[model samples]
Every structure is written in structure tokens, then in C-alpha cells.
Target chain A: MKLYDLELSGNCYKVRLFAALAKIDLEIVPVDFLDGAHKREPVISLNPWGELPVLVDGEVILRDSQAILVYLARRYAGQAWWPEGAAQQGEVMQWLSVASNEVQHGPNAVRLVDKFGYEIDKPQAMRLTDRILGLLESHLSSHDWLALGRPTIADMAVFPYVALCHEGGVDLSPYQALDQWFNRIKGLDHYISMPGL
Target chain B: MKLYDLELSGNCYKVRLFAALAKIDLEIVPVDFLDGAHKREPVISLNPWGELPVLVDGEVILRDSQAILVYLARRYAGQAWWPEGAAQQGEVMQWLSVASNEVQHGPNAVRLVDKFGYEIDKPQAMRLTDRILGLLESHLSSHDWLALGRPTIADMAVFPYVALCHEGGVDLSPYQALDQWFNRIKGLDHYISMPGL
Candidate 1:
């Protein structure tokens, strides 16, 4: 299995972190993101979106980090990471949607602006970050995991960006519950760290 | 099954469209968006996000439309709409992430601005819309569907927003391939139409 990786990207980190915890062997093929290699040839051929963290296992080529997590969890990690049954899967997927949308727009956008010098509305990004973090803090205040009362792909999908919120210039001091949740995920067996985390 | 729906929301319509095609019996409970019903009470209790298109089936309560589609497809429509196995599910999920992120930020944001007078950067929304639509057009130029070479939840997840791009002031005339793909989805068995379509 090969993963098109970027060391600093939280999206890429999500897959790497999951692969480590799940004990799945993956060949990390670093993309020359700074030189726009992802936007060019071979990468574009694999994903029309031209995004990093593309996972190629045999005939399966997945682009989105959330989707890659889904594939990895379902195929290799068994039902522990991504549970079966429609309801539980849907519950886990709700967080994946949040990870893709709210988490991406909020913490991820801010990170791009602060870390990578991307032109984005910083104020709006911070607002969105606070909004999502506030929700996470509230949810984590009473629960240990994002879905199904267990650590599923929901945590894997949302963990990276939220843990890297500081790099995005978003303060995590107010989110005590979220802070503890982050630590809990960090303590997981075989957990790996990315640049910011 | 009960679906918390808003007639004009593309997110809600995605579920409705999928349920109609899949022939799942869903009781549509219209949320009074104008009266702030979605943001209040029972809705918030079901989903902390307080977003519409919440599906309540027995013990399950799903908040996101993409997640709801997953639940409905897996539970009722079998593997045809969502597909099984690792790679096929990931292929379908890649577009679900797109629907949650790019489509939500692009065409959905523009529509919120133009139709509902929401405060959002129209230029940014249009740029995002153009970027995604251009990619979709290029992909559809060769393949008949977004994933699996068949009409899966990938098509349903992205269909509503792209089809409603005109409401967001996005002209779809230039993308001949995208138009054909949209028409093909429209011609699917048991397909239903929303307000914009």
C-alpha cells in the first residue's frame, strides 16, 4: 500500500496516524507539494482534485483523507475503528462529514493561513474554529469519543486539525474537555505524531 | 423513518432524492426554517450541530445529509447505492466528502447568499464552485458516473448542489459533460425533483 503524503498536512497526518494505530503497512510517497507536484501529472492522474494523502492499495485509489480513513478502518482495522450496522456507521460518518466540512473550513483553513501563508479570511476562520471547538468541547465534556461511545474513525477524522489548532492561531485554552480528548487519543497504542502535534 | 426536511435546502433534498430512488419509506417532517425551528428545541436535542436533514430511524439519529444517505443506503437500499468492500466504499465516500466540503462551501454558500441573503463572500463561493465544477466536468467527460462507473451515493451527494448552481448565480452552460451527467442522474428510476430542479 502506498500513501501520497505531505509531512505537515493534518489531512495527510490523519491517514498516517490511523495506519500506525491499525498496524497497516503503508509506503509513504512524499509529494513535492511546494513545487506544485500535486497539481501536476501523476498526482492529477490519480486524483482529479489534485490533493495529497492519496492512498493506493492494489486497484483502490482514494483521494479524501476521510475516505481513506474509511477504507483503512473497514478493510484492515476491523470493526473497532469503524463499526458495523447502519446506525453506528452513520453515527461515525456524521463526524467524518464534520471533519470534512466544519473542521476543514475552520481549523484547517486557519492552519493554511497561519502556517502556509495562504490567503484566507482569518477572522472568519477563527470564528469557525471556535464554533467547532466549542461544540467538540461540549460533546467531549460528557463523552469519551465522538460516536458510538467508542474511539472510532470519528476521532481519527477529526483529531488532526483540532490537535493542530494552535498552528492555525486558534487558542485551545478554553477547550479543556477537548484538550483531554486529544490526550486520550495520544495515549492510544501505536499512535504517531505529526509535525504540529 | 423520519426525516427532518427543509423544502429549499439542497442538503435535505439529497436525502429525499436518494430515499425516493431507493424506495425507502421516509416520513418527511418539515422544519420551519423561517421560524428558527431547526436551531431550537427538539432539533438541537437530536443533533448538537442543529443542522437540518436529520434522519431518525428507530434508535439512530443522523444529522448530516451525507451520513443519512449512508445509513439509508446501507440499511434499506442494500449495497447497490453505497457499494461494499473496501475500495468501492472509499470511491463512493470520496464524493461524499466533496459534497460535505467543496459543495457546501461553493454552490451551497452562494445559494445561501443569493437566495437567503446570507452574509458570505460571493466571489470566493463562485471560485470554489467553478473549481469543483471544472473538475467534475473533466471527470465526467470520460466516465459516466462519479464513482464505480454507476449511479451511487456519490452522484446523489453531489447532484443537488451542482444542479442548483444556477440559483447560486453559477452558469452551467459551459460544462457540457456535467450537464449530461446531471441529466442522466435525473433520468434514474424513481428519481424525484426538488424545488430548483
Candidate 2:
């Protein structure tokens, strides 16, 4: 399996981190993100959206980090990572939407603005970050994992950007339960780290 | 099953539309969205996010429109709406992420700005709408559906906002393939319409 990757991207790190935990051998092909290589030629052909972290497994080429996590967990990691049944999968999927929407617009957007100099509203990003963190803290206060009382792709999907919220100038010190949840993920077997974390 | 619904929300309409297509009897408990009811006691108690279209079936209370779609499809509509196997689910999920991210920020964001008088960057929303619509047009040019060669939750998840793009003052007349895809969805059995559509 080949993953088109970027060193600092939380989205790319999501796929990489999950692969490590599941012990899947994945070849990382670094994209020249600084030179806009992702927007041109081969990478763009693989995913017209020109996004990072495109996974090519034989004929199955997938984009979006959350979607790739679903693919990896379901195809290789048995029911532990993603699980079976409607309610459980739906539970896992809620966090994936949060990852793509709340987490993306919050910490991820702020990180892009501060760390990478992307133009966006920093105040709005910070506000969203605080709001989502509060939600996560409340949820984690009663539950150990995001879904199914175990480590699932729900945890994997929402972990990266939230873990790296400091890079966006958002403090994690107040969210103790959320911080504990982050530590739990970090303590898992075969846990991996990206640049910010 | 009960759906905590708002009449104008595309996300809520997604569940309503899908339930109609699947022949599932859903009770619509209308939320007073205009009066900030969703952010208050009982509604906020159900979903910490306080978002509309919360599905309550027995002990399972699912939030997020995309997640609700997964739950309803897997439980009620069988594998046709969600499908089985990793590749097919992953294919469907790719567009789910697009719905949560691209569609949410693109057409949906613009619609909120124009139709509801929300404060947001109109130019940025239009640009995103154009970009995503272009991608959708290219994909729909040869394929009848968004994923797995048939109607799936992928189409349902993405259909509402795109169909309502005109409410955002974004023109869709130029994207013929995308328009055709919208018409195809409109012609589906038991398909229902929301306010903008």
C-alpha cells in the first residue's frame, strides 16, 4: 500500500498513525506540498480535490483521511477498530463528521493560518476550537473511548488535530478529560507521532 | 423513530428525504429553530453539539446527519443504501466526508449567508462552491451515482445542499452533468423535497 503523505499534515498523520496501530505495512510517498506539487499532474490525477493523504491500495484509491481510516480498519483490523452493526458504526461515524467539520474548521484551520500562513479568521477558529474541546471534555468525562467502549477509528479520526491544537495557538490545559483521552491514545501499542505531537 | 427536525436545514432534510426513499416511517418532531430551541435544555441534552436532525430510536440517539443516514440505512434500508464490504462502504464514505466538509463549507455555508442572513465570507463560499461543483460535474459526467454504481447514502448526503445552491446566489446552470445528477436524484422513488428544492 502506498500513501501520498506530507510530514506536517494532521490528516496524513491520521492514516499513518492508524496503519502503525494496526501493523499494516504502508509505503509513504512524500508529496512536495511546499512547491504545490499536490495541485499538479500525478497527485491531482489520483485525487482531483488535490488533497494530501491519498491511499493507493491496488485498484482501491481513496482520499479524505476519515474515509481512509474506515477503509484501513474495515479491511485489515477486524471489528476492533471500526466494529460491526449499525448503531456502533453510526456512533463511530459521528466523530468522523466532527473530525472533518468541527476539528477541521477549528484546530486544523487555525494551524493552517498560524503554522502555515493560510489566510483565515483566527478568532473564529479559536472559538470553534474551544467549543469542540468543551464538547469532547464532557463526552470523555463518562466514556473511555469515543465509541463502543474501545479504541475505534472514531478516536483515531478526531485525535490528530485536537492533539496538535497548541500549534494553532489554542491551549489544551483546560480540557483535562480531553487531555487524558489524548494520553490514552498515545499509550496504545504501536502508537506513532507526527511533527506537532 | 423520531427525528428532531428543522424545516429549512439541508442536513435535517437529508434524513427526511432518505427515510422517504427507504419507506421507513419516521416521526418528525419539529424543533423551534427560529427561537433557539436547539441550543437549550432538552435538545442540547440529547446532542451536546445541539445540532438539528437528531435521530432517536430506542436507546440509540444519533447526532450528525451523515451519521443518522448510516444508522438508518444499515438498520432499516439494508445493504442497498449503505452496502456491505469495505471497498463499497469506503466509496460511499468518501462522499460523506465531502458532504460534511466540502458541501457544508461550500453551498451550505453560502446558503446560510444569503438565505438566513448569517455573517460569513460570501466570496470564499462562492469560490468553494464553484470548486466543488466542478469536481462533482467531472465525476458525474460518466457515473450515474456518486458511489457503487447505484443510489446510496453518498448521493443522499450530498444532494440537498447542491440542489439548493441557487438560494446561495450561486448559479448551477453551467454544470450540466451535475444538474443531470440532481434531476436523477429528484426522480428517485419516494424522493421528497425540502423548502429550497
Candidate 3:
């Protein structure tokens, strides 16, 4: 499998983190975001949205890091990462949506503005970041993982951006349970880390 | 199964629309959005996020309409709605993320502002709406459905908000393919509609 990746993006890190934990081999194909390679041929051909972390696994090509995680987990990792049961999948899926929605709009958006200088609504991003962090803190107070009582793609999906909140100039020191959850994730076997995380 | 819904919420309508199409029975518990019922007890207890479209099926309770659709399709419906294969699931999931992220931030955010007077960035919302609509138009021009060459939860997840974009003052007449896709979804077996669609 070939993963079109960017080193600094939390979205791309989600795939790399999951692959490391799952022991899946991927030929990392780095796209030049600064040079606008992602918006050009090959990358844009694979994904018209011109995003990074596009996975090309033989006949299957996927955009969206969360979708790519689901594909990789179900295809190579096993049921442990992306369970088969309905309720289990639903439980895991709630976090995946959060990863795409709240996390993206919150910490990730703020990071895009602060670190990459992308024009975005910083106030709105900060507001969403506060709300999502509060929710995660509340949930992590009782549970060690995001869903299914064990580490799954749910954690993988939401981990990178939340862990890298400082890159967005948002403080994570206040969230004790969230901090511990981060430690647990970092302690996982074969775990990988990306820049700014 | 019970769906905590608001008749005007596109997110809630996603679950209700899918249930109707799949012929799944749901006890629609209308939440008073205008009266702030969703933020009160019972509803808030079930989903701390206090979002509409909370699905309670016996022991399982879920928030987020996309996750609720996944649970319903995999459990009550069949592989026809939510496929079992890895590639298939990933294919459908790409659109599901689009529903939660792009569609939510774009059309839904605009609707929230225009219809309910939400204090959101309308210019940003309009920009995102145009981009997502263009992408959808391009995709729908080539394929009849969002994924698997058939109607799946991918379409269900994205349809409500896109269809209701007009409520946000988005003129949809230019995109013939998207209009056609809308009709296709409207023509589905046991299809249901909400206000402003």
C-alpha cells in the first residue's frame, strides 16, 4: 500500500499512527504541499479535493484520513481495530465523526492558522477546541479509551490533533484525564510520532 | 428504537430519512429546539453533546447522525445499506465524513445561520458550500450514487443537508447532476421528507 503523506499534518499522522500500531507496511509517498504538488497531478487525480493522506492500496484508493483508517483497519489490522458488530462499530464511529467534525474545526483548524498561517476563524476554532476538549476530558475521566473499552481507530482518529494542540497555541496541561489518555496512547506498542505532536 | 429529533434539523432528518427508506421503525421523540429541550435533562444525559438525532436502541445510545446511520444500516438494515467488505466500507465512509465535515460546516452551518439566526461566519459558510457543491456535482455527474454504484448510507448521510441548502438561500438549479441525484434519492423506496426540503 502507498500512502500519499505529509509529515506535519495531524490528519496524515492518524494514518501513520494506526499503521504503526497495527504493523501494516506502507510505502510512504510524500506530497509537496508548499510547492502545490497536492493540488496538481497524481494527488489531485486521486483525490479531487486536493488533500493529503490519500491511500492507494491496489484497486482501492481513498481520501479522508478517517476513511483511510477504516479501510486499513478492516482490511489489514483485523477486527480489533475496527470491529464488525453493529453497536461496536457505532460506538467507534461516533469518535470518527468527531475526528472529522469537531477535531477538524477545533484544534486542527487552529493549528492550520497558527502553524501554517492558513486564513481561518481563530475565535471559532478556539471556541470549538474548548468545547471538544471539555467533552473529551469528561469522557476520559471514566474511560481509558475513546470507545469499546479498548484502543481502537476511535482513538487513532482523534489522537493526533488533540495531542498536538500546543502547535495551535492551545494548552493541554489543564486536561488531566485527557493528558493520561495521551500517555496511554503514546505507551502503546510500536506507536509512531509525527512532528509537532 | 427511539430517535430524539427536531423536525427542522437536517442532522436529525438524516436518521429519520434512512429509517424510512430502510423500513425501520423508530419512535420519533420530538425535541423542542426552539424551547431548548435538547440542552435539558434526559436528552442531555443521553448525549452530553446535547445534539439532535440521538438514537437509543435498548442498551445502545448514540449521538451524531452519521454514526446513528451506520448503526442502523449495519444492524437493522443490511449490507445493501452498510456493506461488510473493507473497500466497500471505505468507499461509503468517504462520503460519510463529507457529511459530517464539509456538509455540516457548509450547507448546514449556512442553514443554521439563515434559518435559525446562528452566529456563524456566513461568508466562510458560503465559500465551503460552493466548494462542496462543486465537488458533489462533479462526483454525481459520473456516478448515480455516492458509493458502491448503489444507494447506501453515504447518500443518506449527505442528502438531507444538501437538499435543504435552499433553506439557506443556496440556489441549486445550476447543478443538473446533483439535482438528478436528489431526485434519485427522493425516488427511493419508502423515502420520507421533512420540512424545507
Ranking according to lDDT, highest score first: 3, 2, 1
TM-score of each: 0.98, 0.98, 0.99
**Candidate 3 residue runs with Cα over 4 Å from true position:** none
Candidates in order have lDDT scores of 0.90, 0.92, 0.94
The digit string of per-residue lDDT tens for model 2 on A1-197 reads 99999989999999999999999999999999999999998999999889998999999999999989999999998998987799998999999999998999898998999899988877777888889999999999999999889999999999999999899888789889988899999999999998879
Better candidate by DockQ, 1 or 3: 3
Worst 10-residue lDDT window, candidate 2 chain B: B119-128
- What is the alpha-carbon interface RMSD for each candidate? 0.8, 0.9, 0.5
* Residue pairs that clash (backbone atoms under 3 angstroms), model 1: none
lDDT of 1 by residue, A3-22 (tens): 99999889999899889989
Give the per-residue lDDT digits (tens) of candidate 1, residues B118-184.
8777887888999999989988999999999899999999999889989988899999999999889
- Residue B137 displacement (Å), model 2: 1.3
- Model 3 lDDT per residue over A1-197, tens place: 89999998899999998999999999999999999999999899999999988999998999999999999999998899999999999999999999999999999998999899988889999999999999999999999999999999999999999999889999899999999999999999999888876
Please identify which of the two predictions, 1 or 3, would achieve the higher TM-score against the true structure.
3
Best by DockQ: 3
